[model samples]
Target: MRTTLYGQFVAGTKTDEVKQIVDKFKQYNVKVILDYSMESDISTSITASNNVHKSSFNTELDESNTFKIYHPDERIFNTNMFNYIKNSNTSRELCGQSSFIAMKITALVRPLVLQKLNQFLESRITDHNLFDTIDSLLTTKNDFTHSLTPNELGEISNLLLRINRIIQTVKKNEGRIFIDAEQSYFQTAINKIVIHLQRLYNRNNLLVYNTYQCYKK
Candidate 1:
């Protein structure tokens, strides 16, 4: 399976191997879209919470518990962003112009954070139109931190800075970025953030593209 499924899909784990594969693709006039695959979804945390509740009667912290939660700190997320940017720069170096970078907001910011933001927006914005809600989110003067608590405001700010760093790398490399979409529950927040990036960086040229699932309503 590793030689077939993983080998057919993944480029390589090492820089030299990946460069060789990327160059081979370039020989066929194909551009690379490098994606950082490490991510944690909100549903994982929810399931862990359920398991923890189920084990509440134990009254002791079980070191052998298999269901660990995913609450990554800002430092861990920043490290991930740094590695992502480094890999993206390497891809640009190997593939040159027209190469693309694919990134997920959930990878940069905590999925739970996105879930909270989505819940807040859904509660505040009553409109059924998705675009309308996004526009409302973008136009807000408070930078979408109006009703958020201090810690949440800090998280949002850090999340924006991380995204900006990624986009800035794409702009510097003269490459484009594809903001990968998430599940329906997280899509609204992702859309709002990506549109904000488009407004900022895509004024002169199309550099940021937001991906949407066609099968989704």
Candidate 2:
């Protein structure tokens, strides 16, 4: 499957469930560098009732984000969902096919903790509402989020704590994790977090990998 990091890492999807995929690939007998389709967003609701949100985030892209009002078709990639997956399951623990069975982190965690963490991240550090950021473009809007100014430092503490937790978990597990490249708007902040995480977990081992995306003239 052409999975994103969100799917494979965050959602804890079953590699066993994709036995057909594994079998097909095994035919070549080469190797696999798998990516996941689920992200922290997958943590939202996996039950039958949550299919609406699942379908949208998992398969479809829409013009819903504040930035999309200007950069329509832009993908926000749902931080809450990504955070949900990262915080939910254990990289070290899980049982299934041996691909992950012969694995490392070998731990397990609930999805709720991740949901709470991302909620904290979404609110306190990354709390600005959609309308607030794009108030000028909005025709009819109440000024609830406007009064709150950005708290640069406070905005990062939630992320800082979360990143620390991720590094600790990954190191404790001996697993490799990757961070997808992001748009330039978030490059500075994301890079800072990655650097901090690398120092803590990957000083000796290459546990964390980052994608490099560039703009061409």
Candidate 3:
């Protein structure tokens, strides 16, 4: 690990070690942006037929139905969320106030699910009500899970929880977060989530940002 690109670009593996490097940069007035490097394990293509379950939002879901769609294991996702919260807190402490942290939506939610959601959103891109439905979900004022299957809704709920935790940590520390933009296939879903977060948090301060790639078509 110490002989290749990972060794050269990665700050360090441990918190203390990374802090040492960050401290050096701090001496020169350079702020550090910490990002967990974990990527989703799934890379298969999404199909149009795999649309979200259109059942009523209050419909009860059976255990068998949970895995009928794309969803990561509960333990794994929770662990990642915990690590994200802890890492962000540590990052804030290491870098001091107004620190910056980078996050990937793919890290919290399955990529295939994102693709499916993106496909659904793109299909309804011209519908103003669809956007209003999404906007209402920012503060949980209304239920938007009606458009998603129970499994997809659960996954999205978990993702929102994870992101909310991270956002609260960053806010308490007076730091900002940058949500990384992914491939075109998933960018639409990512943008929606980030924008909602921006609406909730940026109303007072620019605590959240969405990244745009110039190279994407």
Candidate 4:
């Protein structure tokens, strides 16, 4: 079913297939914005209340029982993005122009982590220390602290590292990346990460672009 739909709308399923599609597009002076269409689902059981408890801030990333079990695909997002980068690079060389890739943050980070972070940001605390506070809470585990468990922290760290790698790859290939807007629940975290990437890569021109879904408005 998906194959039929992909054939109708999507470029292709594999790298070589997509390259062929891109080649055909180049014949018409068209460019491609490669995208990995994986989106995270909101788990009914996972909530901000379940992860956060108290106001204590010190935390660390390690293996622990308190961390939420992550979806298996979370580990595979980076691999998919890596493949996309490689394909985009090939497409660029084939067409002799800039290539673009679209990303959905939920594909890289778990929705639960984003929910907890959003709750933390919305809380009556200092906004300037947001990342620091999140970092401190993510690095340590204590009964007195209300923050992410060691395993969750590790997962978040891995997600951030993967995002950084994607940005680095795009920069290296002289390509551009655009982040897709997701549900409202995850937008804040998405925006934060996108802004960070934009600051780093969008120095002279817009190497990173973030989409805002107007239909939601």
Total residue pair clashes for candidate 4 = 6
TM-score of each: 0.77, 0.42, 0.79, 0.72
Candidate 2 residues 1-217, lDDT tens each? 4455654433335635444455565678733333433333223323422433422332222334222111111132224323434432332333112122111110111122223323433444544343232212122223223422122122233334434455555555555666654434344334444555566666786877665667635
Report residue 187 deviation for candidate 1 (angstroms).
Answer: 0.3
Cα displacement (Å) at residue 94, model 2: 8.6
Clashing pairs in 1: none
Give Cα-based local distance difference scores for all models: 0.72, 0.37, 0.72, 0.65
Error of 1 at 86 (Å): 0.5
Estimate the TM-score for candidate 3: 0.79
By lDDT, the better pick of 2 and 4 is: 4
Per-residue lDDT, model 3, residue 30, is 88
User: What is the C-alpha lDDT profile of model 1 across 1-217, one tens digit per residue?
Assistant: 6657897778888879888888898789877788877677887656644543333332221133421222335555777788879877987887778768888887776677688788766675655454453345444536456555444455666677778888899889898889898888888778778887888899999999999988956
Tens-digit lDDT track for model 4 on 1-217? 6746657678776667887988798789888887767667577325533564434433432243332334443435555556656655765665454678887777766677777655654562455554443344454455213756554556676676667777777777778888898888777667766776777778887788988879864
Residues 4-44 of candidate 3 have per-residue lDDT tens digits of 79756798889888989898997998888888776563443
Q: Which has the higher TM-score value, candidate number 1 or candidate number 2?
A: 1
lDDT of 4 at 136: 49
Using alpha carbons, what is the TM-score of model 2? 0.42
Worst 10 residues of 3 by lDDT: 61-70
lDDT winner, 1 or 4: 1
Cα miss at 141, model 2 (Å)? 31
Evaluate model 1: give its lDDT: 0.72
